[model samples]
Target: MKACLILLLLAAVLPVSAQQLPVDAVKGDYIVGALQLPEAGVLELQSPDGQLLRRQAAPAGESEFRFVALQSGRYRAGLASPQSQGRVWLTEQRPLEAQLPEVAAPEAPLASPKLRALANELGAGTPAFWAAVQASGAPWIEPIPDHPQSWQVSFLWRGDASTRSVRLFWPVRQGDQERFARLPGTDVWHYSVRLPSGTRLAYQLAPDVPQLKGAGRQAQRRAILARVQADPLNLRRWAAGTPALGGFDNIQAEHSLLELPGAPPEPWLEPRAEVPRGRVEHLRFQSQQLGNERRLTVYLPAQKSAEALPLLLLFDEDAYVTRVPTTTILDNLIASGRIPPLMAVLVGNPTRESRSEELPCNPRFADMMAGELLPWLAARYPVTREAGRTVVAGSSYGGLASAWLALRHPERFGRVLSLSGSFWWAPARPPGFVAGGLDDAAEGEWLTRQYVAAPRSDVVFYLSPGLLERSAPSDGPGILETNRHLRDVLMARGQRVIYREFAGGHDYVNWRSELAEGLIALLGAP
Candidate 1:
């Protein structure tokens, strides 16, 4: 009774955190959900600007997750898991740029006048789309609802000054957007479009621009058109924009035209050999440093590469290699031209035998990649030698490892892909919550101190979490707290972070879906 009273008195005497509203302003639609982790540990979340929001804890026993409910914005997340040994920076959850899906509809029109206006503007008959695209500087999209069997098209053009016969693209519905058609023999060039019926496609209108300042090619086009093509079950054999014997390929409508110069920060994937092979190379290697070297496998592509290729190294080797088999996804994406061709190195975590040590912030284990493994493979294949060419990736603890590589050895890794980063700062609080009277103000301060000193970098962060978690009912800073805490830290450091949360529990399905888009956002698209 005396001890209880003394504790109560201590709590009463401590300073109170300024009262803020609960995460009440947040709606599920606004939340970026689906935070799953490997080891259940405590985490603290923050805003992009470092404001303490909500808090949650993920213990070590189960793979529970904690997500943050933040205002819609670009934010980064970090994870520092707790251990009897010490608190180590594990993974910094990638940031969440949670764009609501409804926003996509408004963005879909190409611009505003309305759907009909958008359609008309691109010959799909929409002026709103034209106006919006023109005003926003977004790409032109052709809305093609009527021509189910016909290809969609949006033609934003730059006319040739010399009025020479300039080769042009053949626009079509559901055609690729990543390719360009060069004019044949300087004659009047006409791009063709072919597609099957009942197929829906979104299209972009682009001008044939100069190649390496070449003077021979002249052009004509303006306010490039955004076109769409759809047909009523026409079932065409091929949607070939490129004519036979031509050097170019179809620029599918879904593909983006421009790719950034440098590799994406993290959580973004560039290209991978998307076609999974019939026989998986179920290989395993033991890391002397990592202890039980779990199943570290590789998926070799059947399609040959002229030169050695870049690699997609996935953390969380178990689930990602098994259930999702990111390698398989890469193979398919590469074959479809949705993404580029690259190899996959699915690195599993250390066994429960040594997981606690290997996944944490240990520079020794990091050496394995930089010193021995990465270079050994590079010697054999034609892989990118630049740091930017390499993508250090994983989820949960794997997420921590990816981000850590960038910070610990920037010379070695260009980007990191962390999902549901386990920033395990203890914000022992309750659900649907914010930092409570904390039981004490000093507790929050201590957490701030712990986070302020961790290693970090300009690596891109892809983070997502479940909106809730399984922790003591009285614990503060559940999901919201952890997300907010890290979001603030990365943003303050001026790191490129994409923080998001989903309304789901900690599981593989959520991670699989989140990480799938993560590849595109990190490498596939960016």
Candidate 2:
């Protein structure tokens, strides 16, 4: 009886006829499995904590399954029956070029054609090669022989024996970190990427990022911030403190600017010595509808007229005033006759939380803007009451709010200027819906659907979304896709729409230039 009980207990504790095979794979490689099953079952790929990552159906005959390893970790693969089980260990490896950099001089081939040619001439990773690179400046931008629209950008870092890793903190892709590969037997590390000729962005480099053992992926990734700083080789710096409109709080956190040759000209960014300036008055405004008090920065054109001037109500007052030179842009545009003389009310948020609550298609907020704020502004200044001459403009969530307000009160705001609008926003989601997960198709594009359902209004729109604002595979439609969808919906309704895609990301750096372009498109002189 004791022996029988021991055998039963062992059977219950151990897997029956199951073998766990250890498999190795590199990050970004797909792991495929061919299996023979006696009965129809399901194959499941799970995380370390047993959370199902993927599932595939397996028939009673031979079957195959594949899963891409996105990160370095241990994953569990199992069938419905415990007889088939395996463990996968995914690790990240440097590219082949980085591992084989000691090839014969003048005959060696490299992943980058430019680097190959340079290696043929001066030898790879030699002191003379580095001297030439330093003199030529970086990140080294070279035109692709056949591709005129794109350029190859190579970022280089000089590392010593103590250096373990180098990461690039470019904000083009969310939650993705790029690393530089070290050349074999040399102190040179490099990573190259292709970008459109019109690309303009800010980036930082993190050298020797510490490895945090047993920490989550995000916590480990964020540890790079300890060593993150502007590129030493890149001379151009962004957000260096200038003054009221161009000042940043932290000078040490300044990023290196990368402006391609084809980037659009920001003619209105800096104050011109020849152009007349605008006056900005700071005042406190209290909203009874929303029961909040906030600051408002009012911009009056240099040339004052007795007649009512066209009005612009822009959200995120502080950002427009400080991060972007709004007053300077307005002055230059008005002086050059690109746009008519206009008065602008830069709307401020009462609190950060209030901005979240009020900016995303809030009816009460739109009502306050139309019923309370419009009347208040008309009483204080010689602003227009006609909708055709009035414009509501903002970026991101504020962009969504601008469209919502105009749709809610067309008589108050006829023109909407939205830059990288958050059109993939829905008011509600189904229970257990995970954002940016595999099953994220619950609800989105609420405002676009609202436009389709509601009657067409006499509202003109200027929509601009960056080409780089694309979402990951798990996430739903991103800013660029949703903006295009909104533009199509507006055109289908016979509304006048001007849509453009910029070769940048959802950044204030891009929005500053896009703002002037949007104003010229909507309210420019005919």
Candidate 3:
């Protein structure tokens, strides 16, 4: 009797503080929505103010939900997938409105005056006729960034007699998030952050400057950005001195302890380090929480440069041909030139609970992609900045996420390639948020309804699922019926839809076979 009364009182008090409102009706408010897809991942909701609130699962079909508006200001509807997050512009001016009660800002970060001077000097090195700017410097000209990812960036210029540490300082996310870079293999910083996916913050660096008192407690490790100079043109031009190759020569930890067959001619050749290719990179990585640092690996077509080329943004690092053996399909296709030589970013997924964070349908993910990932990638490669030229692709939970990114940020990406998308899965729900998700049959109908409802999106999609007839006769019937229904609904809505089926189950092999065909459809090749 006492327990029952406590439960009743708890429920009553909860609504008074954490109000429960319908999702779809969330006008002028921000929320995160997630749904469990039938096969792979969860569907999530993201908004413009860096928050995730709504969620719905996929039916191997359409998934939907509604939010109630307890307050009105500016709101956007967001969706989450494995590697990406997106939001619909429900309002024009999407500013950050307080989700909870208003709070005061944290104290300003203590500035290292010496580091600041070095950073400021680096920021002013614009070129005159390009070559003259290069010749004007006699001793040393360090790389300076205009819009660094962190509040401070510092580095040491190995020089004779004495060495100076250059640093740059900037605000990170105006107080929301920031970016930082640290020494290779030394993420001595960033031990306190437990952020969601797609969080963007500002950062800077100082060359060999004194370390801050609470470095790890406040920021992620430092990352290197492309050269920044005094002029906008300098941002476009490369630095005179090459960035450090870091440790391409010392490949893996196992290299020192191995004596295997065909260890290759030079056993000293390490994986990719600095740039975006090979088995590893010199670039620093971040985790959604205080965890281990991830080494980035980039896959670029031969002859890739900072020029206009077909770009495919991959969320899961392992989805590439090498990891997932995706190269087989690409080899057959690209060798025959079925698809153009494109750049692929195989960023590894986040750590424990990062799946829910990065794949969140929250505004933070979009900011991360736009303010974080894109800027990082653009620094390394000559990327196609236009949405019409770029594509986003993923599989399982990743696939669902790919679709969500296209749905919200159509202006940044054009084509979406989803394979074995786990639209049925989502980032795990917080404790006590036991909201029932859509079942297969019901979800299929909702997708059908969305096709009938929402405006025709300015994106192209390729969907392929295998035989589910043996799994659950109900789900099998649901798949076929839902597929056909969505196809017709999309086509009737004037969408260019491409649907196909394979002879396997829900795995990488099936998705691999379908990749070529999907490429042809999206790439517009014969």
Candidate 4:
């Protein structure tokens, strides 16, 4: 029993008129209770330990008091004069409300001409309309006659009386959920998007998602995951029984695959029967500079050469090895002579915390890579010592670290292949520094400014960021914007740069294909 409850029981000798109202609330809930007091008195809010938290003045007769439960715990409100008491239990559940967007009526102007014509002819949300959609399959894709490079993709959902809203969950721009508008007097809910012809991604659909009112916007938006599932109408999916190319296990957690006609083919992802396979050796490497140990995976090419082989160092070892099929890609590239036979070192992080600490332009991490890691590899393998033959590559923060390493020690890493590099990162600011507030002048794009100030180095860069990675207003510049800025800065300084933007997001699926392209661009056989 709580100390507050013990105190309340001990004070039972005082005359009580009416029972106090008990409250069951969620965290962030506004809790209100009424006390039947004979005369005006003070109500004290106490913690579980019987310590007074706050006091509120209660009027005579029926007195009311309110409290905002910011955290999950048991609290007590008691009137000292009448000895009436109330208990409140606050849970961790987020307070949710209905925040659904108003749906467009059937008579409203539909974005797609097909949807408009269908609505006018057969009336949307009817049995006939659903039959037609089922026959044609979803999401209904149509070619834009005027714009050959783009396609109109419409997502559809069938809802019942209980369904409040629907959302499309995809690797969309900055990971925003797309809302579906319901048709009046019908079960049909639809959302249409114009995507590039080369768009390839996986998506899920959430129906009747709970809208959190008291939580942050991101928390409310993520509530869709409770009801998110693969689109039933979408025939293609990324799940079990599919080729082992970095996919999911079960259908419940699966996502529907969306590959447009013009999407680039992922040729090197699968292991080929004809191609010679490379050997992957896993070893635990202890770093003296960072005072930690991590796993390092080395890939030895199938074909052995007399001279020292070119070296490729990649960050996020498990991801590149498993999700990306990096060794298979290397085998295909080497066997086809698209790129020369080279050894690759996939570096793993000791922990998630260490990765966040070290990979964001940390000089100690750069020192460890150049001084300790590379020398250790050189002693074990016949890897090239020349900088031109050495390439450092990664995605996201790993990408940022790759650029930073190359920039700091150009003689160690001559080429940097950064996919979706986070150039928006700056040095750690003092506590309580808002992201884009008044003190934001020296905040973002730290690495970009460093390249501008530092002397020109003999380094080449292959940088790529997804077009969908545009930053929100509050986040300063995002990966796409910051990467473009970095590219421009490098080119202005007469540095060799090969930059490209794909119609995708910050996803591993896109990075897998881009990795092969980057390797072929930088180290392809001449």
Candidate 5:
């Protein structure tokens, strides 16, 4: 009783403010708050990366602020005062309150003519009209009711009338095609189309065709391709530095991702209070084959035991560690007993060229892993050496490498997790083509054909691809179709495979959850 009282007294005397600010909000809505400052001061809204999105000065006593049309992500709203710091989440639209000084008198600001005109056009007070208008562009993705197969995608082309029209360069079932759409209103242009469930797609906005600058027609086309950009408003973006993985040649390009209804939910993606977290040890690995050092981020379970644990080998270690919350996911899974205590070795590629060369069915790379890396890891850590207990996994080209490694040395890697594997790779193509090139060989399932012809291994396979993915070339089908073909071939050959179609493009945003699922399915016990 004495200790409880002392704690209560300490809490009461602590300098930290007891009041919590409102944090939850919907992606498409507004969050209104008032901050009481030193008379009048500057308030700033910042992105998670500290980019200043908006800054305004208001009279000190009490000033009102509204975070309007926020994307689905976390943001920080702050002033110069240390006590006023607060975080907000836009995914779960909830009410929030600010800890500001009491207002003396509230002032109603005059509405702009554009807003007033918009209100008049949509019958100001009608909720449905307001909601529809609010969702009219690219970052604002909404499902159209009564048409279960269709979704409305909006893009705001804020450029002048001379901008011609905006086009979405995306893949469709009939073949890769560019759909040109006009702006219905002042700035927003929208497109509604039917897509299969559980489709993940990445797209860019091609607005304003540029004039050819001292180049031929081909150069002009290349320039136009370079101008394609990810949706500015869509915060759920793909990882950088792995361009051409999505079939685009522009290294500077960023593609926006979209998840249709069927995408699997990864509840373990977030940290849970009751779940015990794991320890991540970073190490530098010197590869004899590559003749350079690479980084490896390893995840070890919270509860260590004398028994060796199954090992999960991942490619693009840096992205998994920084972008996807792999450790958190593992913690939740292990805590809930959904998966056994396992070790994850995320091996990073030294360079873009090296990653492409090594990961895509490179026998020399496979030989190095079998001869050097795996043995080194096994000797150092309490890891299972049984082929069935060792899992090799990766995304895109890395994914191709995982399967190839498993197929070549089934005695070492008995399980394979291929997320959007590049089964379309052909030996006839150039080195750069390994990133995005699809060939006529075996209808874009070249590797799958090779696997079918060869003797089947006892390895288990998990293949995941986005449904919205179309065939890369105009002559062939997209990655999704190729993956399905691979699945069929693998199954027909009597190889065990788990095939799933997620509502995502060829990006980690979708693969992160699939990775979790693959681990649980392969290594977890009921």
Candidate 6:
């Protein structure tokens, strides 16, 4: 009788402070929270991984919750009796500027006592429960904070038979291994990992059994087909589906795109009604060197064509046109006279394997661009043949190819815009394979030594590195390190090198800005 009276007294007094707390919080900041409850109850705090960290009793009123986060990540705080919860981010310490709200109660259950009871079991404030709900009956990835420089991406999958493990096709993971955690008492799987800011990554999730490792390509692909899925929770997707490659069929294989915070703004990516737009011509022709037909996207500036207009050959043509907003950028740059009126030919790769095969320091690819593609473009368009007026540009592997083209055929492509170039490539070592391991001097130092051994002139190079590009598998030395090494080598060889670094990852999101900067620096009118 005394306990029931106390509970009634507490419930009446707890509902008075019905204010919502500030959602944003940093590590080590004290949070003064409020919970209107029928009685005093225990509040539980959980880590990002769902590990119970602390539990303490709170009175039915405004209460002080002190926190000191040792690391930067996401955390969950909730109370038991009324069952209310909230999310907190522990980054750099900052003052709380918002008011706390009354603790919320669990939703009244309708049917499915099992699910309802489970929902009550896992606090509504818990990331685990929220992740499962957002997945909408499919695998999901929910980033803790919408805009985070370093993100803790939570992966969720509901349990089912025939699946042993879920694997991620991400580069930074250790040994491309599968790591998943199952939720207690629920048919749900989860895993979380931290990634740097502005990382534009395309990845797929696959359910695999150990037996599939030794299976044939067709068999493995069949198994993969049953399991591989784009993150259901992540709304952003890669612009296009990656075509088939290396006999493994996934004709419509689409990967999910995760764009971390701090991507450099490419103002030209959006079409501005005020800015004059350029013309895009889609052209296709047979390539004698590659033994296949290829597609081209040519951007013609708004300015009237000249008898000898400078030309820029951009690899990964489709991506630049659709993803980078190339035409819009050209229109703006040409209108403002930041760069001279020039023609740009975007060359598309037929397949992922073909792109990888051709874009890396390949002599045949260089020959194809200089001997076949250039002449074909010049025949139809009034473009300059002078090397000084010609530019070869690309990002990542294409960046490596751009530098290789200028070095091999300076008479054709005299200017190179290499954004996050794979300078770690070498004649002896295949990309990403550590033959004898990291001790091999040829890792990222390959291309830099080539320039040291046989220096070339008449080529003006624009080298840009993303600050967040710390490592890549095939390149050995990673993205940023390789670009820096190449820059140092170019400077030492007395080459005219324009080197710059931007705040981003080794992604197109970062390269878009570098592309604009490089063009203006190399082709800008005085």
TM-score of each model, paired residue for residue: 0.42, 0.72, 0.41, 0.74, 0.66, 0.61
- Model 3 misplacement above 4 A: 1-284, 287-296, 304-306, 319-323, 360-363, 424-453, 469-485, 524-526
Superposition error at 115 for model 1 (Å): 41
How many clashes in each candidate? 137, 0, 96, 0, 18, 2
The TM-score between candidate 4 and the true structure equals 0.74
Which runs of model 1 end up more than 4 angstroms from their true locations?
1-279, 286-294, 425-458, 469-472
lDDT of 3: 0.40
Best by TM-score: 4
lDDT of 3 by residue, 1-526 (tens): 4534533453453222111222333343322232322222234334435365434322221222333233453333433443433222221111123222222222222133433353345432222222333333211122224522222212212222222223332211123122232222221111122221112221233222222222252211221121111222122221111111111110000000111122123211123233223222324466342243433455556544466767676655533423244444444455455677666665554332344445534345645665567667787776778776677777644665676676667778778776655444322443122222343333334324534767787677787654321234333333334445556776887877777754333434344456666776787564
Q: Candidate 1 at residue 46, lDDT?
A: 56
Best of the two (1, 6) by TM-score:
6
| Residue-by-residue lDDT tens digits, candidate 5, 1-526 | 4534533454454333211233333343334444544322345666545577655443323334454333555656566455653332222111212111212211222123333465568754355544654465344445666878765544433444444545565533344334344333433343445565566666666664333323364434443452466776566675433223223332334567766666556687888888778998988889876586777889999988688899999987755765567888888889998888999998876643466667777677888888889999988999999999899998878788888888779899999999888777755564334343333563455577678878988999999887666564654666787788889988998999988877656656677788888888788884
Q: Residues 307-362, candidate 6: write the lDDT tens digits.
A: 68899898876457645767787888888788888999988765434666677776
Query: Taking the tens digit of each residue's C-alpha lDDT, what string does model 2 give over 1-526?
Result: 4534533453454332232323333443334444444433455566544577644444333444444444556666666456644322222222222121222212112447777687679987788988887787788888988899999898888777766677888656543567778777777778888889899887888775544334476545554544567888888888522111111111125578999989988788988899988888988889987777877899999997888999999997756776688999999999999999999999976644466567878778888999999999999999999999999999888899899998889988999999998898876543222221112444788889989988999999999998888876656788899999999999999999999999888677788899999999999977
TM-score of 6: 0.61
lDDT over C-alpha atoms for residue 56 of model 4: 50
Question: Compared with the true structure, what per-residue lDDT tens digits does model 4 show for residues 216-313?
Answer: 86555545544567898888886412111111111124578887878888998888999999998988899987788888889999998998999999
Q: Residue 114's C-alpha lDDT in candidate 1?
A: 42
RMSD of each: 22.8, 16.6, 23.3, 14.7, 17.2, 22.1
* lDDT computed for candidate 6: 0.61
Sorted by lDDT (best first), the order is: 4, 2, 5, 6, 1, 3
